[model samples]
Target: METLLPKLDSVFSTDCVIFGFQANELKILLIDRNEEPYKGWRALPGYIVGQDESIDDAAERILYELTGLRGLHMEQFHTFGDVDRHPQGRVITVAYYALIRIDGQQELKPVTNFARAAYWHPVKDLGKLPFDHQKIFETGFRKIRRRLSYQPIAFELLPEKFTLTQLQTLYEAILNRKLDKRNFRKKMLSYGFLKELDEKQKGVSYRAAKLYRFDRRKYNKIFQNDLSVEG
Candidate 1:
């Protein structure tokens, strides 16, 4: 009998497009690459997957290793397998994206030498990225833009207690358009899942705004009824 092994040409990697909202701006996390094919260029945090690791586990490891953040709401959006996508050989990549709240407390320090540093770049200020990452990011961004219409993911990117204006700002940033204030408030309130809080925002130079919190219990109860009706 003879030993069998995988081909040297077959390689797989995972790339992440981590998105965050800060100062009313949509941003994506990029790392300064330390190794070649595209050394010194900024790119999505990514690397070759371990042979024994599952794709999901590999994504979690890669994201944490490059960004030092964990427990994110990561979702696999697409896979890039173009023959020339990688300069080294036949490398295929699985791409994932996550939306996180920028609380100003999280530190981003790459754990591996492959990346020198990690930073966030505003979505609108981005230029051409190294490798096929530009296309990978575009695909993930479009997926999130479309997913926003059907999912309540925007709530995940807001503070625990936020004003209606803050909520609207987040939605407008993701959708990339102005939403009518009156209609937006009406539709959001109609859901009956936002609990109006007694406190107002502090530290503002001008008039303070009342705060509201997302009531998960109310949302679950309301949507359960809708699902039951549809079922």
Candidate 2:
């Protein structure tokens, strides 16, 4: 007896929520769509996955195709499959998120025809995004906020040498609230992973603040000790 195979009718795609911190603002990368369904509208850098590629490979490829950005680490967070999420047909999108230090000199340009341009938009008052992307952004934002509590992910969004005020500002931007300065500073210093440099912020209108860098080696040792104790 022969068995019939089900038809492959559904399509799969990937979207990226890349976050960066600059000038005391938390921003996400967005692209201006050139194709139909939501033409001329800003949306997450996304595209359909190829039939011959894995989801992870597709995510990286599509992101580069749409925004000309590559090599930054990204992690899958959620899958959106609302049936009507896409205007054409049944499309399931896997969303990936990454935090990176923004380079003011680097220009964003789309290599594909699907997107007209790519730029960073402040996460606050983002207004509305097309194709259920608003909800997707909200979910990714919450995931990062939760991860910030346990992980040193916020450090990824800061420069190599940053002021303590800049670090606290990044935290408040992600947490969406102001933190007590003295308490926040004391708690962060207690971690013993921030290496205070003999330098100060330059070219600032306000008084210069002391610069600090994340000490990865110390952090790793501390993490290893905690694991050993748990074991």
lDDT of each: 0.85, 0.88
Q: What is candidate 2's local distance difference test score? A: 0.88
Model 1 gets an lDDT of 0.85
Top TM-score model: 2
Residue ranges of candidate 2 with Cα displaced over 4 Å = 1-3, 104-106, 223-231
For residues 103-211, write the lDDT of model 2, one tens digit per residue.
6425688899999999889999698899999999999999999888777888899999998889889888988888888878887877788999999989989999999
Against the true structure, candidate 1 reaches a TM-score of: 0.89
As a whole number from 0 to 100, the lDDT of residue 203 in candidate 2 is: 95
C-alpha RMSD (angstroms) for model 1:
4.0
